[model samples]
Target chain A: MMKRSAIAFSAITATMATAGVVQATTLEDVKAKGFVQCGVSQGLPGFSNFDDKGNWTGVDVDVCRAVAAAVFGDATKVKYTPLSAKERFTALQSGEIDVLSRNTTWTQTRDTALGLNFTGVNYYDGQGFMVRKDLGVKSALELSGAAVCTNTGTTTELNLADYFRANSMDYKVVAFEKADEVVAAYDAGRCDVYTTDQSGLYAQRIKLKEPDAHMVLPEVISKEPLGPVTRHGDDEWFDIVKWTLNCMLNSEEMGVTSANVGDMAGSDNPGIKRLLGSEGDAGKNLGLDPGWCEAIVTQVGNYGESFAANLGPETPLKIERGLNALWTQGGIQYAPPIR
Target chain B: MSTNHDISTAPAKPPIWNDPVYRGIFFQVLVLGAVVLFGLYIFNNTAENLERQGIASGFGFMNTTAGFGIITHLVEYTEESSYGRAFLVGLLNTLLVSAVGVVLATLIGLLVGIARLSKNLLVSGIATVYIEVIRNIPLLLQIFFWYFAVLRSVPAPKNSIALLDTFFLNNRGLYSPAPMPQPGFMWIVIALIVAIVGIIIMRNWAHKRQERTGQPFHTFYVSLAILIGLPALAAIITGLPLAWEYPVLKGFNFQGGLVMIPEFVALLLALSIYTGAFIAEIVRAGILSVSHGQTEAASALGLRNNITLRLVVLPQALRVIIPPLTSQYLNLVKNSSLAAAIAYPELVSIFAGTVLNQTGQAVEVILITMGVYLTISLTISLFMNWYNKKMALVER
Candidate 1:
């Protein structure tokens, strides 16, 4: 009887879906709602978190605002839906949110298999372990037979295992489901080590009562390039997001700033002219007005401004621009020419 | 066979259009046809979409090397290992957490549930509070509480909290002595199995003797003696061969112990505490559903409270409890999927999240995950149902 009812319900649901009762393009619905419904992190400090007045801030959060600035010309034109790692993908796939801009790592499977389009790398991270400084452990190699704490169901878990086996270390693993619990178990002296991305380890460390006592190990075991992601099959929307990031990177490269964007829009530099929509039909080619990139730059500021505001040395996160700097400056940040 | 024929014939005599049996069959056929048609349509559309994008579909990529790095794995794997191997390792990890979580949850749950009904108000209240606090919060939140707030506070490896001389706890995980197997371990295992078989036979004999001659044997004491005595005798005969590979305070961390990571701890604790709440309610209902008169009569017969519970109340209560409790257990096993939220590398994390991304076979990956979970749920239900039937009273 239950099975029969379930089948009927499913059939009705399929019929409704097939009959176009629900539009598949949530991107349009989001625009109609006057805001991009972006899923972000609950609170990872600089990556994504709430501020003093409960306003969301962070490098990842800025990505959402940038998209909104490009789409709606208002940086604040977005509804933030804070999501954990597990719920983020499903929420995007299910159309519960428009784009996932959490501190999510961009991987092959999440990009291709989960039908997600990663806009671009926002933060480059790597899996590293943290332990108390008094442990005097210099390398992860000394972690053999250690009770290593790591979060379950993540690339970190797999990376932890691979790192250990590759180094021929025989360690015991303590797996948890949240970053907070890993810290708690560590705080209660339950586990001997904690493992996560270097950035997360830093973000989580600040919340600890005595943050100074622990130290993140120097060796980053695995690469964890975190980025923003969108659903697949919407090329127009994907391009909009991708170029939003590109525009930010290009804005910084072209010496544009939130303070100077308006004045420099009439500048003579051709690359800047094209990027700020003062010259060339670059935005037209991408199916948007010539002013789209200008709106993104003026409203959302450049990538450097966003970075410094959220995670740079000025903020509480105090993250250095190790690899996030411009390509000409020996950093990885580079965007193709607007032409 | 004759009855089936008669049943078929009984409803077939009327016109095919008005026949109830034929109508049922026709409706079923229509529903089945619609399902197939819908399924085919979706399949066709997806295929065309993929083809338009020039994305080939197949599980042929299973053997392809996965370039992604994994943090930890039980078996050997590298970036060069096949995706299939990576998936298998992931499945093992999932099973590993579920198996461990199940055992621990049951132990803690049974204790707390019974404590809630204890004569002591303090104990009952504590148990009640435990259930209430864990039950109301989302399991994910609980897991986060354990992982971040709890484990992150531990001292580093060198300043580890020593438990006994051999075990140590630090921010990492629980490190205890891992028994390095010796030659006599097999004999010990065999002796333990023999003891179990003997106990089962002894229990049957005790039951039969009680039924036939009204003679009751103390099955517990006899089983305990057999279980311990046989293992001891075997060990002694094998020269009492045993060695403890105790974890020691090595250079920076403990060495030679079976370590349980903090992440696994948070997952287990959250999973157990969360599911145990529902189990407690199930147990309470099962216990309360048994008439009070049964307990009162057992007391009237001069049976001790423990004996009364063991012999009368519990046996009946289990009949009501087992089926529902099994579902709770299954729910727990499924909820372990949340291990991904914290990166526990259960099915969703390792296979669906990791492997599918690397391989790009979304359908194959998702189907496998769904199938694995369904199989696990079915097996657990079947086992519990069998146990429930066995415990059920045979009233004449």
Candidate 2:
């Protein structure tokens, strides 16, 4: 009797398993849901953070907006899910978010082992250290035997360990799971040095009680190519999200700002015309309307515009575009041609 | 009689559905089969989904190097250690905090519970207020208050508060002298063990002598003296085979010795005080469940107040206390997981939070963590049940 029941149970499960295999495409799922679910950081200023009025704005946030514009032609059709460092990849892999636009580094292990793919680098960053002025530590070499505070589950933690071990320095680590906790611990003098990406160091310095008291050290420990991530299987959705970032980068190279994109669409330059969707079939290749790039450029602006607005000199972070400028502008930021 | 026996024995069996014994067995078997099928379906579905997602599912990740640093570890762990060693480090840290928290909470709970029943109005009132306030507030908030508000307010390492030129207190940690054993320390250890064994034999003999002669012996005082004197004599004879290493200021912080990080102090304080409140209530209930007539009976037999309470009331009250006390202990162990929030590097913080994220083997890591907690809780339950059985009343 038990054997017969087991066979019947297996049959039922087989049917259920087959039924579960028929899943809708991510883009179609997003369209049906009427919004793109974007995973962002809990709060990292100039990357992805909320204002007092609850409006999200950042370079990373603009990536999500651009993707939403490319898909739905309305930048506001994106919902945000704030995730921590440890929870971000799981949130994307478990299908809880349509796209992960958080400031996540593109590492070999994460790109290959995990069921995720990095579309492109949005911001080129490197791990650095920040110390209080009173500590009088000018160079990274002077930071021997210092206690370092950093967020857990990030490349920064491993880099800090490697740097210290390579230099034969004795140091202690006080790793927290949240960025805010690491800041709090460092601010409370629990650690002598606060380490993260250089851009993050500048961003978090403003959150300190006395921002002027701390200074970033002159050390770039590791290459941190921060980018958006998507699940590995869906090629169509991945192409759309990937090209959305490319559209912004390409627009910047062609001097197509959001303010000038409307007028520039009628230009005689074939490159600008093709990029603005006035000449080529770029949007159709990604399964979108012809005016998809136009919507993205109009609503979320080009890459330079987003950078200058969120993380430029006028912002509290005052981060100079050292390694994040365009390739023609003496930095490594480059994108392929629209054609 | 034979005709009646035939009528009773040969009454027709009801239909199998109407028969209670057969029907019960059939339903049980049916439910058991359904449960087995449901479990199999879930297991198969999860495995299939994980495979489809391109995630490697297994315990192989435990062999990889966990290239992250933990803030605190009870075992010898470094970034070069395997993920399995990291798990052990996290487990040991969790056990260390939980064990210390249980012992401290019990001590505080017992004192407060007895104080609540004291004759002095001030004592009872204070105990009542402590229980009410602590039990009413949330434990996480209490942890935050201790970590951020109290411990972090201490002076930094540059201006550490030094005590007796040996210990120092700072926001980083409490640093003190660590004992280093010399070459002849083994002799001292042997002497201490021998003294303990001798004390146990002496205690048994004293108990028997008292039973026969109706006289009491001061076994506790003698055992305490021998425990201290034997070790001290051995140390003196061996030319004092111990040295103290004091923490001193190095570059940015103290360099060597023993340091208890503020995260641990805050977590231990929060866990002990919060769980202590519930234990106080349990202890109070256990004491109150004992009848007042038992105290009166002891006093009528010429026993003093303290002796009556200890010998008569407390012995009976403990039968009620041990069962509930076991639950409070289990709660303290579970509540130690909240240490993760304050960065204590316990099992959940370092293993589940950091290791799981680094490896991206969420299913395997979570299952292992859950298995660990289940094992710890079941062991506590088994030990407590055995203790409860021993304390149960004996009947003639």
Candidate 3:
């Protein structure tokens, strides 16, 4: 009896050990699973917030949709796992998500040491401060000795500390783990100023009790290039996510909206035809179908369309596409050519 | 008859499998070997998986600069401090809240427990209601109530509620005067230590004298006088080697002084009150476990009411109270991890939450945090066991 049980125990241990040793095949895994698992923020307006009807609509959400469209030719073939700032990276690194489309800042250490790859910059943001209008604070430098509130486990907290120390000013930080708690703490006057990405400042402002009473300061402290991320060591899957974002940017620069992508597929311009998969093997090189770029543009829309629908002047956040505009329009959002 | 005796005396050996003792030993060895193999498998699997995922592993990340600010730190820390220092800061904050919570819980528990047995109906009723109400609610909700509902409603820094023109209370925190020690402050501290030592010796002498002469000396008042007098004399001789720095209103908030952030207050209040309710129940059970005969015997001996309760009944009741009370203390220490939910900068909040996120080294950070909590819990258990041994009944 003892010998038999021992043999069984060894078998169980061997199987358990081998279970975790499977090689990284995220693209194949996603294909077999029939949907791409995307990680996003818990709730950041104009970035990754869900509506009352349980439908998520945001600029970051569109990235995941584009990847899903490129992979499955179906934009809705995606599942989102809402994560906090602390849980986002671990979720992607552990294979819990195929891609992390959260508004995560791209930093050197994260790209090199964290075993993750940043696909491309989706938004160019900078750390900014927001204060009550009655505080009479015009610039971030003027707000010395202020109690600052921000979310923990993010670049915002580090940026706030660096900005104060460099300016020879003393400050108190009241950081919370969740964005909602930070908003509540700031609204309760627990802090004198709320600091985060300028876009985040605008996004979180709407959550305040009196959104109009708060104003974002003019100074930008740190460069925050926000983008989507995927696990490293999987070049095939990485290329798919990277080129999916590139497809959106390239399509926008070519003036191909979701409304006009079908007609542009047959255009005489070789650049447009190759981008739409009618003239070159761009899609095959990434191990995707021939019409992957076309699928992304038609189903999820280009970068400009997603930005306009989710975060443009017509939306509640009313964010202008200044740094996010195409390079031809004098912004820095230039993508590599499709050819 | 001799042949029958010789035949019976010859013993027969059983097979190894049929021998109960050998079977037990064999099975035990098998189980131990299996457990060892399982543990080895898990360790190897984790190492392989971490390597396969390309996520860095090890404690080297602790040497890197933390580059962040913590709100409540007991020791000197800065943005340039190492992550190891950040861990220490977080550990100290956790220790502070847990230590204060344990003391306050014991005091409140003792008071409420005795009150529940009081003859006065109102006092017992109130105590009973307090235990039922506080212990039944979830601790996290209580924390939220204290933080958001109670402290958040306080006035802001601009209109801080001033006390004695030195201490202030506002939504940000409670600011008070901080003592800045000068060169001769060491002499005053030495004086205080000497006074404490003197009090301990006097108490020992007083206990012996009372036993021999059957007359008690007033040791409490004498000890109190020495404790204060020695410190005061040293301060006068040293020309007062301490200066008080009061908090003053500056640009946006209070400038200098000691401050207790609201997060600490809310967490401490919630932990103390919640644990107090459980301790109160344990105390009541302990007191009731002592038979009624002991109380009646004390009364028959003509002891006063308060004296009989304190000297006779309490010593017996404590034997029953301590073991369970130790468990409550352990629970409070472990529950302090909930401070993460409210951003109290405790070990789990700042170290495991923020540091783990920043470095992406979840395995190492979580292991270190768990190890710290284990060490703290074991220390508390060791101390409590020693205390329990002292209070145990000694039979003649």
Candidate 4:
């Protein structure tokens, strides 16, 4: 925890130091540097977290690993820069990080006004409210006059205001800059309700002293399509990140798993052949090796595999793939074909 | 002397670099040119970067809707308020916290400073411990201690700790009765103003009479009576035109009162306490700067200890204290920006953090935020300079 706060403070100073340094041709820069400096959240379980041994994991981390695999054919050829929400964009804009995959929402203002390009939604999420079950608040409509705790510099605070005001309910918002501080405040009963993205709510619920005492309400207030973000002007880097997600989604749609990717490489299906770069020059088009898809699958796995590995029902967070499942699997995760 | 006569011959005129007046002007111009170039370099880089990234560069975003709610705003604000209004609200909150912290910290610091000078061991020892402990720790950690560790430990609002039936304390905040002035409150206000004018005139007359007749009057007692007694009389004649809106536990938290959130409490406590330690040392140094001869001289004239310290020692010490004391005041105000860490809705946290994030106008938002702090520092320094002048020694 001490190391984490120290990193956060340093990240702030680092962002300030590198402010307004334009990083164009980021693809060339990464290729020359031999690694992608990926900006991730300080620590959000089921998204991006650093373990005791300082290894990064989760869906967001896998996005960076996949990009590294596509670029250098090695998943380990990547570095992590943990950023707070307030520092994330500045870090990205100032060239501190090649790509920001910190579970950030893809809103219109951020996409247009913030000089950011949201490649594609890696996780389709929404604003959610969690409350202690003993409060007898079964639904969000019953949460009038409740004090809500959320992190600053995010859309959660704004969404909470819109939701409560639309429902004609009075509420107080207690915002903290750090995610853990919000969790701590909510756990300590400093607020009556905790609101954020649904995935975040599930992840932070475990931090409470009595995790079983809380229940997430059924209402989702806002559309929070979270994805990897790159600077707006760098079309090549944007294509690299966008295709990385599409490749993962397409591979999953084609029934490719990390365990069977090697065997599927020899398959006779033209679509599979084209996707794995065994028969087509799709990887060449993106300035990558021919076997870029194979490298990503063999190293990181498909989108579903990454999700089940990090946030499935068997995992601690137990987040369901309500909207993140593949198109054929009765969910909204659709990807463009490799061809 | 005749042997070294050739060495005394007039030397050749030196180069411009060796001429002190020319060198000073040349170096000053060089420095000014370098500074201007450096500033323009950054400006060009920022403009290019912003243009390349498609970030709009201007103050136009200030008029956009903030779409956020503030916990405690001095003026009216809602989600509908523009970002400009939100900036003003944040500025007011920052000034409010810093001003209150300055007053509270000065009082505590003065008391602690004087106690450290006490002959009693326990009193001085406690003051010493406080100064050492508080001054040694980082202010951010102290703020975290008060916020996450102390204030967050308070009980929930349902079981709020009541204070005098008009105040409540809970994890949410401290609730105190908000005074509501009625129609007749105007007459009381007018009466208080009249009493102040009357007292000022009386003080001037008393000073002249004392100088003429050498007969001292009880000016302090008379001034106190006029200030308080006039207000009391007006209130009674107007049937007590002030009402207290006591906080009641209506729903989730206290209502109908002035609420000070835990964020405010923790920020105020941390800033004041941490700054207070530094101030205590300053006060101690200032007091010690006064020579003991002044105190002995006063005692020789048969003045009491308190009177001698106030009339003789403090006046001299003020000269030493005012300069460094100005710096501490400025430091406290700037350090109040750390209120951003705990989500205190101060200038930096709200305007710089939320507005910057929402608008994505880093350059504009940061420039304006910096200007606010600059303005605040200048205002404080100007006020302190005037006060220092008023307290300056007038040597004959």
Candidate 5:
């Protein structure tokens, strides 16, 4: 009976989808709804996870808040939908969420093929392996013929295979759907190695029964530019999301912390003036308020602050800002100039 | 003259709306129109949503490279294969597991069902407890229990338990020697086919002899010898031409063998065992539905106990069993999608779960997956319907 109905439903949907023009403007939707629908991960420490009081907090979560601030001048005016890895893309594509800020890796296939535009990198990550220190495996090169555990719906598995195959190493994979399952299997010694993004390795390592017993190998296999994603065609909404993160980065580069954003707004810095809407029409051109960047910087602080708050050395994950640091600070995290 | 006019006008046809046949046709047309309108509305909404989001709506993505590896595929597959190929691999894997599970579950179910009706009190009681215990627990939990609790506790690959220096068991999986077929394997297959044909001929001849002379022949023993003895004789004549690729520990894990991943083992075990319990109850009911008089009548015809069962009860009982049994087969096939939970690389896990995530073509991927399952289910039902018709009692 269920199957019969499902078939009938699909047939109807198929007919209805023919040549119909559905023009989706996420900016308009968010404005009309009074809140941005943000798609987030089910839970990933320091990326998108709940706090002690059940409030969502993470670098990825903060990206959505920044977008919300840019759009509505209110950082808290956003509702999060926790999505599994498999459901995130569809949720975004189907317009179920205005923006997907779920630590999704920006890839060529996703950006072009899946009709998604990655706004900007919130976290610079790479595929890395984690193994027990007692295994006498100091490097990833020693992991030939190892049974590796990883999450199924992730690029980590593909990267693992690529890295191994390129090096002509034979290995076995034991993949799970959920991150916690992979961690559990790794913990239970079901596999010799656990592989994922380096940040995820640090995050999940803390969940292990004995955190110090495992060591992350010193090899970065693939570049993972984790960022928020939006629908491809809405250039206006795309600019809003993209510039929201850029505002944070540009603020950090200009040394304008959240506490001193107001003071710096009055400064003689022409770049700051333009970014804060004191001088130009950059924000207005993107269909947002003139003070859009100001709201982002004032409410969510700069990118460094968001990073420090969620994933800095003080946090449980204790991930350092390596490639995530500004280009001037010997890192590749550079945003285009506001002027 | 007024009564004649009323009759000539067909009682004014009661108006078309008041006519029963017209009303029925009108209602059906209304319902059909409403359904089509509703369908158009949803499709238009989805199309607008896709167009608005700039998501491409089509099956063109199937041609793109999959760029991933499947752990165990029956067919040759590579990371460089197209999404279409990957989908085929997933489909085949799903069918393979379902087919194997169906056969195993039927065997176990039949045995348990027979045991449940045994004269021995302990045997029947144990069978009842087994049925009740397994039937009540959810299959997903059973899969989890086997995967997480039982399988995960096994020793790691470094300390794999070696059985007879041929098989290796570890947390990763059970690894045994894989048979490498030699050139003579074809002849052995041919020999088995010939033996089957020979058995059929033998059975026909025995039946005719019995009818003519009122004498019985042990067709079962003769058939069994032909089947087993022919294969053995072929293997001997062919010098037993086969090599074994035994699993050997190299560095961190075993290599060079047929490795059955623990996830698949757990999923198959869970699906088969769980479905088997329900099947057992169905079998018991089916057997009981065959009246006691049938058995008594067969015995009165001087047929022995085994012959009575094989010739009388089973064929009749099958007709009562088939409809529900068809549903169970469908249930098992659908349940095999639970392989996703265990990451066994079946249709749901690979093509639907991972490929959907990678491609982000949810509608297309889901449609294809649904179509595959629907096709499988419809085919099974059609086959079972034919079998049921054939097995039904023939009446003059």
Candidate 6:
């Protein structure tokens, strides 16, 4: 009887010990799972969306695939989970999705309170309104009691209320649960106006049946610095996600692209040598191979290539790099220099 | 002969494990022990995990200031209030939405359910189509279609179509006058409560009179008049002081009125319509479950169609309907969590997302949310169970 009780007690203790350890090397877990669970926005054009063949491609998807490439040596190792703004943070914290690259704003509350760590800003956006062109409303201030369709459960909704209130203009708000719904309602004439991050407005506008009928207003309301986020407990996983964005930014600054990364990796430039693993074991420090940065650039293209492919002027979304351009090019797309 | 006599007259206390009476007690104790130990293990692990991460495991986060901003709430709040206050606001909103949805769904569901059984083919067919379409589709999809596909299509404020002089319809949501409370409003409120109490007393008296003397009274209509008339009389006697803050057409939007955001509108409409479909089916099944012989007997005894339904069929049907209806109510309370999807500033968004991120207390934040839901579900269950026991058929 005593032996039986002892066995039961030991079993209970063992289970507790195993369960108490919250997070370990998330990289190992992702590798074992064979795919990185990537949280993405719902159908943000150029940021994340499914092609006709059901394959996801976008600026945001590249971030996920880049991380996957750095971890598992394969860029195709990603499982995309589409999330709205409200679902994005919980999904990250609850371990529903490994990394959230859904153009989520890094707010003070989110960074400090939500048990989440924003790795780095992937996109810098601002709250802006988009309206049908035939309305002849050139500026945000031109409209007084404008009925606007905005996303609910987001900072955008609050910002809209504040902007209209601060301006002392009376306006009505039509709030929707999803960005797609807001855009759809705007298209269907359910809402007189729609507001979101400027880039999102551009992407949504392109998806409209009457694309030319809408124009994005020039007034940028709130500062929205969007980035990838991870749960806070796992430092190793945090570093991996953080460095992936850094790699993209560093690669872009170093002029590395899918086409030219091979040549640069072999180049005699000290900066290139250090970054491409030609000089030292910087890759080992990150628990990756020396060619980790090289693989990311050659396989996924640098940040500039991704931006141009997804939302650049030549693309269907037709967004210009006014604020998104590289630091050297007068935009805010600058990163701390690679050591 | 001796061995046979010994077998027949042996002691009634069987072998140790073979005693069925002790066996039952042992099984119960074993089951109880397993459950207790399981719970203890989860508690221990959770405590250790919290300690390991240097995270404080408690409801202390509730007292901490919620610097996060919430978009739409039924109450006023600032960025510097305790998180507990925000949680209370969320709970109140959940109850508000659920209560409104339940009342609306019941009215519609009963009408549609009865109409489905109507003699008129056109009316029944319309009701049937509504049931088949709504019940077959998912609740979430219905919410999406309402918010995204249907409500989002409203025109801009400049193009807002006028609904009478006092209202306008645009994508922004229905706009109407904000109720302005006048002086002596408190007296009117008191009069309404007193009138409701009077109706309850009259209903009990009517029930007893009918039982004793087999006499009928128009209790419902009388109660309605008293409840409504008393309030109306008080408002008038107090100088009819309430005024309307009418919505005025402004340059780009409506001004000076209560605005219902489109998210709330869509969610309320979708939840009601979808849940109403199920409630209708339940009502239909319940009414059908009552034997047709009872209806035949009531009609054969010279009862009117409405009288037979109200007197005989409804009481039985309610017994069947009440249990399932209560479950649906609980489901609605839980499903309001979906409001987080559209940014409605409910518990999940504010407490789970904002609070969890701000504090880095994953287990605590999620557990609190889970606990809140569990409490809501369990409270509803307990109340409904008591009601069920009261209504359950008793064997003679």
Each candidate structure's count of clashing pairs: 75, 0, 0, 0, 3, 24
Docking class of 1: incorrect
- Give the lowest summed-lDDT range of ten residues in model 5 chain A: A16-25
Pairs of residues at least 3 apart in sequence or in different chains that clash in candidate 5: A16-B43, A22-B48, A24-B52
Q: Write the per-residue lDDT of candidate 3 for residues A204-300, one digit (tens) a residue.
A: 9999999999999999999999999998789889899999999999999888989998788789989899899988899899989989999999999
* Best-performing candidate as measured by TM-score: 2
Q: DockQ of candidate 1? A: 0.20
Q: What is the lDDT of residue A285 in candidate 6?
A: 78
Q: Tens digit of lDDT per residue, candidate 3, span B134-174?
A: 99999999988889975567898889999999999998899
- TM-score-superior candidate, 3 or 4: 3
Docking class of 4: medium
lDDT of 4 by residue, B82-168 (tens): 999999999999999999999988988889999999999999999999999999999988988999865656789988888788788
Provide the fnat value for model 2, as a fraction from 0 to 1: 0.59
Cα lDDT tens digits, model 6, A1-339, are 999999999999999977766565678788778899999987888988888888898989999999988887789889999986656766776578999998888887677555578898888899999988988999999867676777755777667767876797655555556677667667777656788888888888877999888889989999999888887678888988888888888888988888988778778888888777888776787888888888888789889999999988889888888877889999988877556
| DockQ agreement of candidate 5 with the native complex | 0.53
Candidate 3 has a DockQ of: 0.67
The 10 consecutive residues of candidate 3 chain A with the worst lDDT sum are A16-25
lDDT string, candidate 2, A22-67, tens digits: 5899989999999999999999999999988989999999999999
Query: If ranked by lDDT, best first, what sequence of candidates would result?
Result: 3, 2, 4, 5, 6, 1
Local accuracy of candidate 2 as per-residue lDDT tens digits, B288-377: 999998888888899998898788877788899998898888888888888777788889988898888889989889999999999998
Fold similarity of candidate 4's chain A to the true chain A, as a TM-score = 0.92
Regions of candidate 5 where Cα sits further than 4 Å from its true position? A1-24, A262-268, B1-53, B119-121, B295-312
Estimate the overall C-alpha local distance difference test score of candidate 3: 0.92
Q: Chain B of model 5: TM-score?
A: 0.89
Determine which window of 10 residues in candidate 4 chain A has minimal summed lDDT.
A16-25
- lDDT on C-alpha atoms for all candidate structures: 0.79, 0.91, 0.92, 0.90, 0.89, 0.80
